[model samples]
Target: MNPVFKEFKEFVNKGNVIELAVGVVIGGAFGKIVTSLVNDIIMPPIGALDRTDLSGLFISLNGTFYQTIKQAKDAGAPTLNYGLFLNSILDFLIVSASIFLLTRAFIRFQKRQVEAENADKICPYCISKISINAIRCPQCTSILEETH
Candidate 1:
C-alpha cells in the first residue's frame, strides 16, 4: 500500500473522523430545517409587510427592467438581491441559536446528573446521607476511608 493510503486509512479509522461524519450528516439535516424556517415561516411575514416576495426583491442597476429574477438572470443584468442576503442571514442566526440552545441544555443535564450522583454519598453504617469529604459518618460514628 502507498504511504498516503496508509495515512488515509488511519485517519478514517479514528473516532474523531467517525464522530465528525455523523455531525456533518446531522448538520446537513439541521441546515435544511433552518432553510425551510427562513424561506417558509420567517420570509412570508416579512414579505407580507414589504408587499413583495423576498425572493423577488432585487435591484437591477441597468436601464432594463426585469419582470422576474429568471428573466433578469437570462438577460445578464447586474443586480443586487438584498432580500436573499437577508434570508441567508436569518437562516444562519436560526441554526446558530438552535445549536447553542441544545448544547446549553445538554450541559445543564450533565451538571444535574453530577449533582445527583454527589447527593448519593452516604454513611456506610448509618445509611444517612453524608458529604463525600466527611472524616467520619456523623450518624453512625464510624471512620470514613479516603476515597482519593
Candidate 2:
C-alpha cells in the first residue's frame, strides 16, 4: 500500500503527467471558449447575413416546431440539427487551427534554440571559435574529426 501510494505520488509529480492534467483542463476551457466564439460571435454574424438562426435549422421527424434545440430534445423529437453541426465543425476548425499554429510556433522556437546551441564553437584542436570550419585544425597538427 505504501509502495502503491509512493508510485502514485511519483506519477502525479512527473512533469509529463502535470502537463497532461493542465492541458486537459485548459483544453476543456478552450473548447468552451471556441464553442462560445462559434455560437455567439462567428455564427451570429453569419446567420444574420444568411437570414437564418442556426438553432432554427432543425428538421423534426414528427410534426413539431421547436423554439430552441433544448426544447426539441426535451420533447423527444428526432431532429437533424445540421446548422448546429456546422457551428460545431467551425468550432473544431478554429481549435485545430489554433493548436496547429501553437505547435508550429513551438517547433520554430525549438529550432531556434537548437540552432543557437549548435552554433559556431571553438574547435577542440585549434582552440579557435569556428563555424564548423577547419578540415585540418589551424593551431594544432590534428585532423578535424567532424570532416570525413
Candidate 3:
C-alpha cells in the first residue's frame, strides 16, 4: 500500500476519529429531530396565539405588498424573511437546550460512577484502600481515630 494511504488508514482507524465520525452522524440526525419538534410541535401553538404564521412572515423589498412569503416569491419580489429567521432562532435554541440537558445528565452519570469507584475509604497514613469500618490502618498499623 502507498505510505500516504497507510497513514490515512491509521488515522481513520483511531478510536477518537471513529467516535467523532459517529458523533457527527448522530448529531445530524438529532438536529433534524429537534428542527421538526420546533417547527411542527412547538411553533404552531405560539403562531396560533399571535395570529401569525411565522414561516410565512416576510417584508417585500420591492415596495409592494404580498399576503405571504410565497406570494412575494411568486411575484418576483425580494423579501426580508424575518419570520424564517425567527424559526431558525427557535431551532438553535431547542438544539442548545437539548445539548445542555444531555451534557448535564452525562456529567451526573460520570460523577456517580466516580463516587461508586471510590466508595471504599483510603487510609490516610498508608495511602491504601481500607474497609469503611476499619479502626486501624492495616498497611501501616496506625490507629485510626475520630479527629473531628
Candidate 4:
C-alpha cells in the first residue's frame, strides 16, 4: 500500500474520527426533527396569532400588488420573501436553544461523573483538591487533621 493510503487508513480508524462520523449522522437526523418541529408544530399557532400564513408573506418589488408569495411569483413579480425568512429565523433559534440546553445538560452530567470518580478531598487551607487519604495539604504545605 502507498504510504499516504496507509496513513489515511490509520487516521480513519481512529476512535475520534468514528465518533465524529456518528455525530454527523445524528446531527443530520436531529436537524430534520428540529425543522419538522418548527414548520409543523411551532409555526402554526404563531401564524394563527398573527392572522397570516408566514410562508406566503412577501413584498413585491415591481410595484405590482399580490396577496401571497405564490401569487407574486405567478404574476412574474420580484419579491422579498420576508415571511419565509422569519420561519428560517425561528428554526435557527429553536435549534440553537435546543443545542444550548443539551450542551449544558451534558456539561452538568460530565461534572457529576468526574466528581463521582475522583472521590477526593479539598484542602481547607488552600482549597485545593487532594487525595482523600492525604494528611497534609500539598498546595499550602499545611498539616491536616483527620475529621471523625
The prediction achieving the highest lDDT against the true structure is: 3
Per-residue accuracy of model 4 over 38-143 as CA lDDT, tens digit each: 8899888988997877878888999988877888888888999988899889888998999999999999999999987687888898999888888988899899
Q: Across residues 57-128, which tens digit of lDDT does each residue of candidate 1 receive?
A: 788869788887778889999888877887888899999999999999999999999997886577768889
Candidate 4 lDDT: 0.88
lDDT of each: 0.86, 0.82, 0.89, 0.88
Better of 1 and 3 by TM-score: 3
If the candidates were sorted by their lDDT against the true structure, best first, what order would they fall in?
A: 3, 4, 1, 2
Each prediction's RMSD over C-alphas, in Å, is 4.8, 4.3, 3.4, 6.5
Point out the worst 10-residue segment of candidate 3 by lDDT.
139-148
Tell me the spans in candidate 3 whose CA falls farther than 4 Å from its real position.
Answer: 122-131, 134-148
lDDT score of residue 81 within candidate 1 = 83
Instruction: Return the candidate ranking by TM-score, descending.
Output: 3, 1, 4, 2
Of candidate 4, the 10-residue stretch with the lowest lDDT total is 50-59
The per-candidate count of clashes, in order, stands at: 0, 0, 0, 0
By TM-score, the best candidate is 3
Q: Write the per-residue lDDT of candidate 2 for residues 1-148, one digit (tens) a residue.
A: 6999999998887759878888999999999998988888888898889789875677776789887777889999988898778777889899999999999999999999999767766678658766665566565656677742
Better of 1 and 4 by TM-score: 1
